[model samples]
Target: MAVSPELEGLRRIVPSRFVSFSFPNPFLGGAPNPYGDSYAGECIRVAVLDSPLPAPSVPSTVAMLVPAGRHRDWIFSTRAGHLHLLLSSTHVSRFIILGPELSAPSPRVVSCVSRPEPDPAHARLLPLLLALCPAAAFLGNARHAVPDVPLLTFHDDLLRLAPVKVVAGPVVGEMVVEDVAIDCAPGPVELRRRLRFKRMPCLVQTQVRLCPSSAAAAAASSSLLEALDGSGGLLQPEVGGSLVEPYLQAMVAGLAVIAPSVDESIQSGVRPTCLCAGVGGGSLPMSIRVGLQFNVLGVEADSVVLDVARNHFGLVEDEFLRVHVGDAIQTIEEFSRQGEADMNFSAVMVDLDSSDAMCGVSAPPLEMTHANILLSAHTILHHHGVLILNVMPPPADVSFYQGLVDVLRQVFSELYEIDVGNGENYVLIATVSPIETRVTDNSGQFLTELRKLAGDFLEHIRKI
Candidate 1:
């Protein structure tokens, strides 16, 4: 495989920063499941919109997340097979149609952009246009690949394009088609829209504006998620969510380690201590896995998650493993305020909403977005303290990377990005400069150590 210079540089940086290892499952004694169930066999309807129409037909094997059923017109159900596009008018400018095919018994749905009809209103094709489904029911068994999906698009500009409203029908159970598209002209054009269908039940639909930045990010993030899934600790789907502790464990495993106790005597004029934030359930990621890693305190946002973490994840109320539940931001703020005594921390892990974007909302502005929550974590962490921002950074944005550099430059003396498993997702470590620096170039030493740790981590994971 060919390598990008940036990726090669990132690979070299990983071993120096993280000593990668498998996360040890805390639920060794057989307990309640954490992290909920994996979303599997869920069907969703997706409306792919652009200037030119994308492929007209969606593969039966493709798993689509369509809008909920309560909002709009009904679509006829068809087996997870070919998606038939019944355009509302002859003015359709362009559309692509894709067929589903089977390869490895597991359904593989492939779709492409195409110009199926010569109608002139491709621009007016409204939201809820195309639907998606898993090819399980259509193929008898799940298959991996779909064949001969052509890609086409309409480039010709059409004037006076009328808006077309698309809907999914419930009466059409799987393998039947009903009122899928309705013509609504000269109204506000919704860029993305969703409607629920009964045929493909148990699926949640989300429509996002895809851009170069997000597409790049999605590709990078997915690889990391896949890596986490493949690493031995992911709970087996059959074991009913056995993967939660393992996932938590991996977070712990990937954490930056703070040394034992030189800090008690010289720095802060206090005892050496470690802080772990977002302690959902009692699992301590680094401290527990590495054995007395630090005098650790666990913090969480919700009480219920704390309760669940403690009861389900086997994080007993040990004195060293102190667990606190409340608003993580507020808790950190209060900790920062309550004397200088409460503020010191060796490492902080912020995994607030899994990824940067909240799952349910639509087209929220990135400025006020919670995606940058790590900014808060940066404010409170102590010197030489490490902040682990759990985010999936896509490969395409120079600005996003620059933004992180900007933020970390504010707080830390040095920041390093470590990409685990083929440079997919990133774990950023912002380190505080050591106090009483003996070495001439201390920051460079920290960077060197950070890279060594990261590379060791990636190599360890690859071995597993």
Candidate 2:
């Protein structure tokens, strides 16, 4: 494909760096040791400015030639808790730069029409930042400024990658931008399947080590939530789509309600990270929990909405929560490329809308399903990871969702769907088996346990 003139101009101002990442699936989900070479590795070619390659530098603005049989993690540590990147390149591609300085020269925020709320469900700004300026890096110092929002900072001693885009202007397209690697493998696979064949939405999987008494736990009250909300109580829903506040509240409440069961059931503690799809201020409150944290990724249409999410909603607190303001499809791809393989989020909460059967026509189309999302989430989950999804009702024709269940059945030894309420939004949970072999749904232990945990809480979930 030819580069657009606008992109070319953008590239001049903001150069793009390309690096390849690859990984092997040997143990599937066991404690088998990963190939040593796979962990500490080197790139075959480090390309720069259409040229061959060179050594690493601060904010290293250079491309790398990744070899086969090697996963990207070998070169970049996407799982690092904290990262410090130094910009070494002066080529200034997009809003990112590869250099020794941890900070980019000065990032000019591309202004956009004020969005009442950005999609806190899926933080799109991060991906868009990479899309617009692959060279952009976090002005490390500025990170502290946003205390309320949880941020994920990646440190690549050999490099720094940041995203920048021109938000406005008649020549907006002319703005120089850089490119970043975006994995689209599953997209093609997803598009090939029929609506009935589409897989389920992707969910971060976890194991529910529940306490025998978990079912006896009391439901968390909205009053506890009031404490979290401070004097404001539950703020009225914003005019546009500020789902962040309410969503966060419910998410936090849900975790609080379930954590006791999780702790009681399993000796190992649960550190959850949920994924959902939608644009609203609803997820901020969910970002707060004594033991549980979140990565509320949402997919909304507008960029300004993200600004609203950050500005209006109190989403700027910690690094655990982030908003990816973009189409759900593209946002997932970006995460995959960023090394989701090494990520083991405790839980994945999928609230994305699957096919709509109201019109009798499958919305996602039987051939083009969201199964890829499930497959990807499966790859990202930890051992015995639990997967939770917000499901629609039957007769509404959620064959697509069913297809996901069928696929999960093949891998998961146990699966259960509880009527969190009698509506389209039901909490569907799947527990991945440590061993790859399939397990029968016999004995109903899974459901038995799920009901115990859900109990009265089921009623509250429905109301939300």
Candidate 3:
């Protein structure tokens, strides 16, 4: 992975302060981009350079030199939000560095195309301010300014861990300039930075509370979501693990559409089976409901939670119930790939939610991770399989939740939702086939498509 002379200055390195991120699960979705069509898509061409990686998908070793004209379409990731760099035409150049999210020091933009490797002795390490001279230039033409933001912070404690040499002053990298111009005004400004020492993994020190949920409800959303004033948190043992209304509504609604009355079909010798599953083994309330109605296979990442669910919540591997301990992505991928013929589950209640509100941290729940999860589910999903998702809107940005709804709509033909009694969680039900809209019975109940067996909406799911 020798640095190319042609790309001597196009390194996509981030200043030492920025940190990298890891996304969870096989939730990645492929974003196919076309390289042609008047240079609309960005896929930095590297035919001229002998680089290890290809264009569009920038490898760590390679970086690109893009022009100022096509900056708008080429700046960020083009492949379905995977966050990989894609150049519509890298003939302008191939690249790598700090990804789209974090801001990287800009390279010098010049008309001269020199391919000489400048000697380190002759190369001058510029001051922090000088390093930013070329950044705004290649960012694209409309006007002037930087292309991104500095969202990460440098903790004093983390800074203390760095080597004294790196901590004391600026660190330098080889820079070669053919032709460039940098203009700055006397206003608030930030200089390009490089790390002096290796980054360290920081510890998140925390104290465990015997209580899982706070005694009082958290007001993260609308009033309906707030925990009742007198009601202890939903998990308080005093309540014997109260039922969450949202999950119930979602599960019931999902089952009604997915595994409708087999009683009628059974008499005619066509009994449909319903197999249910939820991602996290949290409390097992959703899993238990699925098990009671039909056979269930629950997947849990945390073993302690799985053990508790088995001992206290009745989650076990039996003729009717099975639980797997692993990432839901892998489990579902396996289920989707293997054993398609014999597997017979009409409905799947997926409560496997991984959100910052519940987990204390956030990842790309909206992008590739969830998309891959849904694609995996689709592999084994019955032609008319139903998917129920427990999507809790995040406290600040709900774009991810909305994005997920859009993804589900794309995967399944028909989609329906039931607000969980709790405002925090909204259960989204999707079916591959259009749902048979329920009708009203004389008793003022939501009469399901097969009303001969179950009278109302609640009763319909109860019977299923």
Candidate 4:
């Protein structure tokens, strides 16, 4: 990772400024930058964005935000030289700065540069960089502990002379040590640990083209729509471990049964809608994958959870996807009474318990019974609509599922159900229209588009 001529040019123009480190990506096992050196209040703080962000104690500027999903993060500049961090969600995180403000002719500026990475040329880099931070905070520190005090002392001396701009892999925040590369520097750099240098995929710099608000909005919308089409409806399929395969397969089953008509309607300028109860970072990712033209309405009962979805999980509710914080059941009833026909959805989905499992914590139950809620969610759907619910059914009590099927059958015209691949959960897809396996051609391939959308879960599905 040699220093690019572009970055070198940036280094030449910018005045020397100090930065403090804040917030650690827990998975990374330690804090990134060490700002232990004496610095004034004017210094900026670099932080790795995560849920439950750490308190910075001082104002901070976002170098980059690398959370999952389709959220884009970049540094935006104005003509007056004032810079802003334009998050992919289009929401701005404010931080006061002593740095220069924008002053150019343009209202904003987009600078495209390669994202930083680790420079392998540095010797004992990982271990050396690892030693920069103390080990008291991490659990596994004692077993892999090295004499970091001496190395810190050494780096302290090196910094006393001149600040070295070092290239570190994304693992170390593309760190710029003052003058010497770690490998060349003198320190007890022993990497007794088995960890090897790992780079995070093929790094591509986020492109920011600063223009009018309209152009920016257009770009973001196109990007989100393109994300589903490009992925073929599969984004990070490994997220939920064993349950993911079946869960997605179930989504496909629902989408499969409705895609033909929904796809046609949208192409003809009739944008179909889907209401997802319980919004997570991956909620929009999942539904949009199933249907590109879908405009999603995400309903979450918890306002805090909705904020987490917006701030942490990158749940941006654009024109295509909208999130509302309210009871799914009550909200649907309200829409029905108001005769908001255009706001009605063709698909209604529920995964209310996703957060309970995701956070490994439980909360009190909602006032409505599960059956009651599902019945209410079904009321606002169009005649050709479908309901996909992710549920936890008792394995021992076969009667539990039987009871649920009975509840849905009372309202829905027909039902198709599949167990998650891991078999921990059941996805019940109930529809108002009938669906059947279509005849194959002479080559024996299936004739219908539904089977293709159903993917591997075709056989797992049962009609009732």
Candidate 5:
């Protein structure tokens, strides 16, 4: 199969590093053609100018320029006129290209266009062109007519179009902390803080590594500590800061629905207070304190974990936000003994997780769910307060979940569960008093109310 003179001439001036053409197989005499008989045997080729590679005998269905490295400059240079002339003379019907680099997880389509109709040779390619880029439109016969909306809108940031080179900086700090009460293995554990990022140079993530070498640590878990913005400040709560985890968002949603008294307390010029257990990275408590304007008391069993939260995750302690480094269970009991007038809380949030994989439950440990602890947690709440728990049951562990729910029913008059839909975690909202509002009966109405109360916080919750 020799190359056609016309295609060879077009290929010579296209500035492509790789190009390949595909023609219908002649052996399949009666096979159906997706693009109809008019283009059944017509040859099609795709060219990408970025990387150097050998052309394939049979190429993929569609290949569009990704426009990275030097190719981006070429696409935007004065030579674009020559590229437009080449496109008009060739059989290619569409071109999909990305705009300047963005903070998004993946490149977003900026421009996609096809040639106008009445040209049968290009019609077969139209269906695929439209499918790949639903925003595709005809730009007369000139490829240069394609709009550059994304580029123009972000013109000021175009300087950032240069590729970011991410190099993991040296460990900023490290420490060893141990607490037997929590689920981690019984040994000295080391935590190291380092910087990591995807593409955006301004958006850097501070991650904490906990005992990466220990077998027990591997069996237990690890997590991202926090994300920071360009100004050396934590990113907005919605970006990667605050309660972006689905289960945490569900817990916030539960809090919004069951604790209406928080609003009243705020209106009366008194800040509502919440007690949060399991202060991993302190995002949960900080979100409630800053976003909802509540006075938050965070309790973590290990002081080292609290230190990591403060030193690495941007957790700050103020008059309104305080942290207690000790056993959360004991703290709850002490609060219960203090009498409601002196130490009543608007909400009690338990977000602890078990270190033992065989424990059958993933979160808030079995002890946090003990009948005594539940009673104590119920005792310290304001008369209208709510208790929110993040519980993760082993897959299809029906007996464990049902037993936990049964125990919860014994402690609270009303129990509601929000399925985070992640298959593992569920946020349980328990109230000492019954919910009287008819809106709770309707699931849609309940979500609507939650949305209203949560506002921007709801953006992180998935599946409503």
Candidate 6:
């Protein structure tokens, strides 16, 4: 066959030095040193000559000229009745080349040339020649061999990667709950159910907006809820059956610190219980009940919010999880009056937002943090129980935050803060009984512990 333009161009620039080799005649049954003993078992490059040469009499003998070099090899062999060329640097004992026809006078030639060092003038032409060749390059020295990777596709509608039809539905229901207007909309999928709340304007006329609540029925699905006021937003999804919001995760981490006591209570034939003061869409309390296996009692000032949680966000009430439609502070005070024997809790979580922007804070209305209210909340917790509060103070308002911390200190001996890194929310964890060693003192250690607990919780829930 005539030499192609790519091969001819390569032959013109490659070095002329070569070591010729040929297979011994099979009929004679004697090994012949075709090239010489010096060239044996050495890495070499090869070039085929188009001109007729003395070919071996063997029926299927291959004759080639090799050059000494440390370079990749471009091998040409027949596979499945077709000629295939592969670029590889692997060492092999022998190679077989099969074809339909063979001749002694003239034989097909394959050229394997070493890659030349970079030259400014030839750099452009080199890539063109390589592009024309039918070969695949592979890393010979890779630590692990790459397996065949099937092409990924989104053909299945149920696949996570599949395109979703997100048609925004109209407001199916609306109601006024405690001066806050609540609207429910069924988003694209059952997993994306949404509830939007608009609270009354603050004294400064700044609109107090509440983040939307979203539910994900599927374990892998997720959605983001942008703050209507644009201060910040929430990632409202139950990821792998665990809370996705950073603030909520921080609150859950507080529960993790007292997990041993909770486990002990469960072992003693009493279910560990938690009080969630602000059950916006009931995600936090639901996660506590389902993910951590704790019985949760949730209190919300507005009954309409609870209806939204049940109708849209998958809030189901059973023996372990229940909600009360009343003032959270009043509920805490009532529980305090009942005494520890009647209604003590293992943990208490407060996630309320302040409608009064004049207070320079965005969470737990000032009344919720009053000295008396804090004392009442503290009294309703078990001795080793923890109180977790989600607070959002004005940016850089250090004095306001310090004042809030001082008030919390009056009721609890131990106080720890978890920065959610969102610039908007911080989780405060306090306990009546001091912890000997606090993991929250070190942020890295705290996060490591939270991750470990979350992993275990997710694994346990998945089994059920």
User: Positional deviation of 75 in candidate 2, in angstroms?
Assistant: 52
Per-candidate TM-score against the hidden true structure: 0.40, 0.35, 0.40, 0.42, 0.47, 0.48
Model 2 residue 421 CA deviation in Å = 2.8
Per-residue alpha-carbon lDDT of candidate 5 for residues 195-306, written as tens digits (9 for 90 to 100): 2221111111233322233444343444312111111221221212334355777787776554445556766789888899867667777777767777999987767566
lDDT of 3 by residue, 373-436 (tens): 7777666666667766656554335476678777876776777765545445566667767655
**Model 2 global lDDT (CA atoms, 0 to 1):** 0.32
Model 3 vs. true fold: TM? 0.40
What are the lDDT scores of the predictions, listed in order? Answer: 0.33, 0.32, 0.35, 0.39, 0.49, 0.47
Please give the TM-score that candidate 5 achieves against the real structure.
0.47
lDDT for each residue of candidate 6 in 1-464, tens digit (9 for 90 to 100): 22244444422212111222233221122223222232233222222221112212211112222121211111111111111111111121111221111222111111112212223212322233232211221123144332121111111111011111122212212222111112223423112323333221111111122323433322222332112112112323332255545577777877655655665786688878899998866777877787666789999877766766665455789999999988888999999988857477889999887654223236767787689999999999998888888887743244667778999888898787777776667778888786754443333322344454344321111100
Instruction: Tell me the lDDT of model 2 at 369.
Output: 34
Q: By summed lDDT, which 10 consecutive residues of candidate 6 come out lowest?
A: 80-89
- Candidate 3 runs further than 4 Å off: 1-245, 259-292, 355-364, 367-369, 437-464
> Stretches of candidate 5 above 4 Å error?
1-242, 358-361, 395-397, 438-464
Stretches of model 6 off by over 4 angstroms after superposition: 1-191, 200-240, 357-361, 395-398, 437-464
Lowest summed-lDDT stretch of 10 residues in model 1? 12-21
Best by the TM-score measure: 6
Question: What is the C-alpha lDDT profile of model 4 across 1-464, one tens digit per residue?
Answer: 22223322321112122222432212122333221121112222232221112222221222222111101111211111112121111222222111111221211111111112222212323332232222332233455443221111101111111111223332112321111111214653110000111111111111011111344444543442222222221222221111122464465555556655575676688777777765543433333534354677777665654544443333566677777878766776677667666856788776544222112111112322256665666667877788887665532234656777787788777887777665455777888677543312112222143344355665566666
Better of 1 and 2 by TM-score: 1
| Candidate numbers, best lDDT first, in rank order | 5, 6, 4, 3, 1, 2
Error of 3 at 8 (Å): 42
Question: CA shift at 304, candidate 3, in angstroms?
Answer: 2.4
Q: Which one is best on lDDT?
A: 5
Residue-level lDDT tens digits of model 2 in 1-464 = 22234444333222223321222222133322222222222212111232112222222222221211221221221111001011222332212211111111222221111111222311423232233322222333254322122122222211111122222212111111111121234532110000111112111111011111122221222322221212122222122111212222223333322343344334444344555544433333233321233344445444554444444333353465555655554555556556654356445555444333122212223422355656666555555555555554332343656676677666555565555332334455565544232222213333234333333443344211
Supply the global lDDT for candidate 5. Answer: 0.49
Candidate 1 lDDT tens digits, 211-264: 112444435534322322222222111111112222233344343333322233
